[model samples]
Target: MFQNSSFFQNFSTLGKEDTPKSQWIVEDTIANWWRPNFDPPRTLGKEDTPKSQWIVEDTIANWWRPNFDPPRYPYIPAHVTKPKEQTKLFLVQLPDKAYFAVPKNFKLVAAPLFELFDNSNGYGPLIASLPQNLSRFNFLYNPP
Candidate 1:
């Protein structure tokens, strides 16, 4: 159906002759985006030092800063960061309310939205047995 189409007529040499018998070859010299060896440096730590900072320093030790002085922003922050305590308070309050309001006969049905574990264990059944409104609250309060 593609009569006189440029795609069919164009016979540009896309591949190189790697072997005499090999017809299919890749001609593009550009590097592919796929990075199997690329491991981004871990940014999470007590000081929040980016992994790249260590990698760059180790790789290019001789490269001096513009004025032969240390950079203004250190590879890691100076402060010792700690996790916030408010998260525990938010988690505990939900179950307490659900315990008093839910009836004994009412069964909690675990939905996919509430299920976090891949093993099909843990909070799946407990969450499934909860009321529909209660199940939805988990989604609503989840951080963006």
Candidate 2:
């Protein structure tokens, strides 16, 4: 199936350019805040621990703590966080392929199809339950 397909080659090459810079940015940010060298050396006394260590911890704790005020946005709620809602999904299988659909209020969390169906041989009643256009379905996982 492999060919000298420039389309595939070019498509793959498109993402390579930003990969190294993105990796470096992530590495630098992590290194700046949590570098191993910034850690207290085994030989060093308690007082010898880098001030950076405390600063990083304080930053993290402040971020997580509700009362810890974030910089200038005083009026904004400090404890504001998104609440996750339970999701329900349906799995519809055709003779050749499978479809995973989520209801309007729910989100789709992609996972292996084999987890729900017996893929050992083939889709059995699962295929028959699906409509001809592959729309009718049943719940894959029920949320509590």
Best lDDT goes to which candidate? Answer: 2
lDDT of 2 by residue, 1-144 (tens): 011243332111001112111334433454453334223334445665333322111111001112333222212244645312211112212223223222233333332444324332232222222232123333465455
- Give the per-residue lDDT digits (tens) of candidate 1, residues 1-144: 011233332211111112222343121211121111122333465466322111111111111122223331212233524211110001112221112222233332334533432422443222223333233343345544
The residue ranges of model 1 lying beyond 4 angstroms of the native Cα positions read 1-98, 114-144
Clashes of each: 6, 0
- Of candidate 1, the 10-residue stretch with the lowest lDDT total is 53-62
TM agreement with the true structure for every prediction: 0.12, 0.14
In model 2, the runs with Cα more than 4 Å from the true position are: 1-24, 36-38, 42-144
Candidate 2 TM-score to native: 0.14
Model 1 TM-score (2 dp) = 0.12
The whole-model C-alpha lDDT of candidate 1 against the native structure comes to: 0.24
